[model samples]
Target chain A: MGLKKISDNTYEIFEEGMNVPARIFASKKILESVEKDRTIEQIKNVAKLPGILKYALALPDAHQGYGFPIGGVAAFDMDKGIISPGGVGYDINCSVRLLKTNLKKEDILKKQKEVVEELYRKIPSGVGRGSRLQITRKELNNILEGGAKYIVEKMKMGKTEDYLHMEEEGCMEDADSKKVSERAMNRGIGQLGTIGAGNHFLEVQYVDEIFDEKVAKSFGIKKGQVTIMIHCGSRGLGHQVASDYIQMMEKEYGFQNLPDRELINAPIKSRLGKDYYSAMCAAANFAFANKQIITHWVREELVRIFPKVKIDVVYDVCHNIAKFEEQIIDGKKRKICIHRKGATRAFGPGRKEIPEAYRKIGQPVIIPGSMGTASYLLVGTKKSEEISFGSTVHGAGRVASRSEALREIKGEDIKKEMNEEGIEVKAGSWKSLAEEAPEAYKDIDEVARVVDELGISKKVARLKPLVVIKG
Target chain B: MKFKFLEHTADVKFQAFGKNEEEVFENSADALKEAICDKKKIKAAEKKDITVEGGDYESLLYKFLEEIIYLLEAEDFLISKVKEIKIKNFRLKAVLSGDKASDYNFNNEVKAVTYNEMFVKKIKNEWVAQVVLDV
Candidate 1:
């Protein structure tokens, strides 16, 4: 497949065979940086899938992935399109959320080590780590069916207002527990409220700069103020679901017949597709609940340390997984399965999906940079609908794998560098620190610049890490 | 034939070069077992038959490994040694034996197997399969 440079920061994957002439928005420099990656091939492969509506899109942070590229966005006609677990990724609903606090940077710096240590102890980390609370089979079923709503309604962890600020209210009504296998349930039973390893973390940051004062104020972010961001997902249960469905789809859909088995998929109308969707949604809900429980835990830890510190959730968004949403294409409202793998939804202002309070300011897009770099807070724009399906880059896309990262950067040295840079770092294992070294990812500012220049999303505020806790 | 583990952003990859596909599959499973549990502690005292059905050879290989992972976690059975292995178009049947949970020395705990970087290909009349297991 030949790609043509349409603009300084954009490339067009011309329509060939089954594709609809896809377009990728990125800077010339960013495109050159990712040209050698297999993600380009994966994006073209996605264009060949059956019933792909509009264009098979990719964000600036795109990288090679299972079936689709990470940071990929594609919408398929719900009636004729196929759903592949590979598109949603193994870590279902792997997402990020920002919590605004009344405390300032000086306040956190006074007790940075203590607060991070307390958070590390309160939040379970590492692989196969389970939370302090173990759920019975019955409760697990409720979690699968009800999602975060169940926790707020039954467990009283948070209120309905909390869900209102979340994407989809932290639950998809289509979640069906019966479709989930027992083995998957077993994996999720004790994993809630736990932060798994590998690129997942909870960082305490300070507002370094405000790009859009209106949007930043709307998100309750003020310069020099403190905030905490949680990055995690459904844990083992989501992985099992992806595995279970990938095999099932391979058999039911005859993967060999497809151009790429990695893109193995079943029509959304098929039983296998429906079951996977239901199970995937359930896993996504599990992630929402997991984060909710973690929020409560963080609040508890804050109360223990600084009783005066008050923290409120700004917004939560899922970067992975697919959702059924209505988008106008060719002046017709059509239902499409929007697959956002390693991407985030950036609904512009006045969009009904935005929370009532945020309806005037657009959806808050939280883009977390690497461990040491600056993170950003952006908002959706109307132009995003024309380019991406109201989607944007999730984070600083990886430039190196864990092995490569470890080879080039040492964990202890990275920790030392972060400390010297005025950022406190703590992790269950040093290996994790090296694996997530800042050098492993692209400069997030360039990624944000591409989207901003393309009018996809507007910058709201920039955040600098004060303390990072990794599992 | 030598087998080594290759790490990815999301999964643990294994590259095994062998004289034949069967040998590679067997070694791939062995490499995965070594990664999960200590081979020395897994005694061949118990015998179990494993069969995985799939739509193609690659998917079959994935399911086959997934079955082994399940047995290791659910029954604490490790594949210390491979007694027999059989592969068809869409099915992998194996006869394996191992002991219960004991002192195990393992490098990385594979949480699950993903469809990422998963393929079975035939090159120069020899079969080679590459799989990335989620760690």
Candidate 2:
């Protein structure tokens, strides 16, 4: 049967195979577009998973992934639910952190090239760039155990305020370094603070418009004010862990006659599940520490270039990662594991988990757009908790494949276009740049409109890129 | 090109074809090496023997590509070619030759090899394997 429209911004499918209804949170335009893609099929597959709570929901940026859609969110019963490596993805805690700078766009317009070049040098980019700072295995383990605190509290590379603005305060207590395998550790040790390739980037932007004055002010964002956004994650370590667990889960669960092998999962209460959970947390912790170190390097680069500029991070939000939380399900408050793949946790105001500073306003949800597009800074709302499981879109999801992009768009041409638009572009190669061309992505403005209309997130400010450093 | 790199919306996908199963595996390694850097610039300065056993041909291919990825990320080894590959009952052994990544320029940082839509089957007279690597 064809999917039914729940609202102007919501649609649902109740097919025979689905254990629960699958929902899509997008406007009429996005819903129609997604129908033509593989997103709906993936969402239906997720709905058929065992013990899923409510519905399998996809955000406006939803796209077909290995198992779950990229912008997918699914909450499962703590006791009856299952945990899969595909839910968390390869790059655990792949997130974006935005820093507010005292400088204005006018101040950095002419110096964009110099600043980007310095940042390009200061922070390593591309594949195999290696770790910017060499840390012994002991220190890496401490990072895995301590999260961002290893950089801020112990190493003194950043301030406590940085940790406060991060989701989960940059430390996940469930992290057990012992659960992390030797291969994962070996892959992780030398890749910290380096931005890996394939859609990962570091962009310098400025607040182009303020939609909500109070919320923007609370976020320390002002019109024309400059900011830096780091997009990265646990890199090699997280990937290794995911690879290790996918094999383990399939072995334990017996992947006989599954819809997809990538959808292999284990019951959350199983030993394999517990081991994967701890290992995932440890890798997530590494991501937090990884971003912290990159922040340190970013700060240093800005200081070296613009000596008087002071930048403070507004918020850091992870798009990937699963978390344990309590939610009202079937009229009962039940603990559940929410797996947000290519989706962000958007806890509205008054949620106890939100930082005290943002408790009155809402949790900051940073949604970075594709290259040369307008990004958005938003906040969670009560409506989000009522509808979505406190989750929102991560970015303007890719609409075109890399091969199609290369065939249609040329890197040098797009780079020149960005330059004409007053955006400084830096990358390992121009060929890589074409694959991430702005044309390859969906209309972020349309995605923003859907979320704003759905009340899952409310827009506070919009950012336009000034300098982009692609990995 | 022994292998053609297909485009997924998000990740890097490839299909390698060979007359035999062993050549398909070798071509897959070549595709992975080309993903990292310009394979022509890479020298066969180092050689390592590798053995992998999987539940099936699909698992064997996944494990084999995963091992190649692990070597690149952990040991900084860039594979230029695979030789003397013997495949029997889902157990495969081969010798990989390449140089240290530090000695050459890097093009892409491939994170993990995934089994999503992955297959190893005979199409007509050729053996073809489709893969997707998460970067």
Candidate 3:
């Protein structure tokens, strides 16, 4: 457990016998915060996994985690490496999206309460609340495989550009419905478009400041402009997929043989690995489609309130996933499975993955802070490829657990405090509100500063939340 | 004596406390087993020897749990309990016993193990491990 400080903002946990060295990017303060938890050890465990290429890297928001630390990024050689369900997370494709509207702060303030209430009424929130799209198993399968593109093609809610703005263009080509278990399909059959509980939210925000005017303008973001942010992902279906795979891997993969059981992985070429990958991709697609449908609903609600208001998508990015992409490692292009858990893909400008419209400004990285704090809009830098494999922090990583937050502050009181600060908060349950209190998470500003200092990503704009709908 | 499923977004989470690391590991396994099926029906069959190696205690635990998960998936064996757990700085070897269920029966399927909200710490003199399995 000896860690060598590589730089002022970086540390390296060298690989021992049968281990790879783990590199962690963070400030001294962030490192100290992680040291208090079990994340450092977990990072070391990730290094021991089979076929782990390069280094197992942890971001600034690192904290204790199961197989990999939250905010962990690792790349594995596609030819020799394995894919683990633990790496992708249970909520497969849990992501965030930003939609810009024509309305300004003044216009939103005129009907803020009404707009917020309208959103709550239109979109279902809380645990187990299903949306209006109640499809059978057959339809659900299509949703799983189709993703946002399917929704766009079938539902005709948005254009092809909507999909283009998304990571992987909203649909992963390898998604195979047959790879998903019947039980997993059943769990997801009725849950599409629903906003589940615990940290999932839909917020109305205002662009208060623009740091990178060129990038902000490219994204159609302007000062005092109103925007909506959707934060959600594959629900029960993705969970069931993870659960089924974990159990299957546990029983099938011998513990004594592998470097780490929590990193229980199937060879990329193995049947189990292929099935899990296909199903995981399906779940990821389901998440994209779910968010797309929700976006349609959000648009409908806005139009109902502000008849002339126009809400257009800014960008959508997946935060939890294992994607295969070619990156120049050691000056040679190599395909690797980049597992970004509690992290985001920060591809530099002009990368093929970025939309053509944004080829000049780079991919927009949205880092949402706590409900009461200021969120940031950042653009990827070429420097990120060297430091983090083109990855960045996802959010204000949680510093306090739900129980701890509930014990420290009352939900009602927190709500009152937000109200006084000119923010509106709405949730189906108080416990949900308490679990997501601002104090429960790390200071996002500090996390952003570290990423900026490291040149992984550059801040583009700052956003202030006006209304929040939590489930 | 047993773990209860706490509501998580897409995973089955359990919080348990034990007097020692061995008990904590045993209890965490028990929690995971319970999460998969009815504990009363999951009887111990032939004993199985399992070993996991990691760079640290936490990784060792993760490897240990993954081993159990692999066994269940590959062999359809449902582990009932951990009989012994011996841990060093970065290596863990343990003995576990469980039966292969004729049919899979559980409330939820855990897809993978996540590093989200994962913990193994000491509270006073007792050891506590909390994990959020990706379901």
lDDT by residue (tens digit), candidate 2, A288-317 = 898899999988888887889887878989
User: Which regions of candidate 1 are displaced past 4 Å?
Assistant: B5-11, B19-22, B33-51, B68-112, B121-127
How far is A238's C-alpha from truth in model 2 (Å)? 0.3
Top model number, TM-score: 2
Instruction: Please say which candidate is ahead in TM-score: 1 or 3.
Output: 1
Clashes of each: 1, 0, 31
lDDT of 3 at B53: 77
Restricting to chain A, the TM-score for each candidate equals 0.98, 0.98, 0.97
* Candidate 1: tens digits of C-alpha lDDT, residues A1-471: 578888767787865565576667778777765676677777888888888887888889987777788899989988878888889888899999889989999998999899878888889876434579878889988988888788889998877777788888888899999988887877677678988777888999999999888778878888999989999988878878888888777766666566567687889988898899999999999999999899889988998889987878899999998988888776787888989999999888788888898998789898999888888899998788766888999998887776778688889999899999989988866777887898888899999888888878899888999889887
lDDT of 3 at A197: 63
DockQ of 2: 0.73
Q: What would the per-residue lDDT of candidate 3 be over residues A268-341, giving only the tens digit for each residue? A: 87888888899999999999998898899998888888899887878898988988888987688888888998
Give candidates' CA RMSD values in order: 3.0, 1.4, 8.3
Candidate 3 lDDT over B1-135, as tens digits, reads 534555442245787678877778888888887655535566777678987776545556666776676566435567888888887676777898888643434332344455355568888988888777653
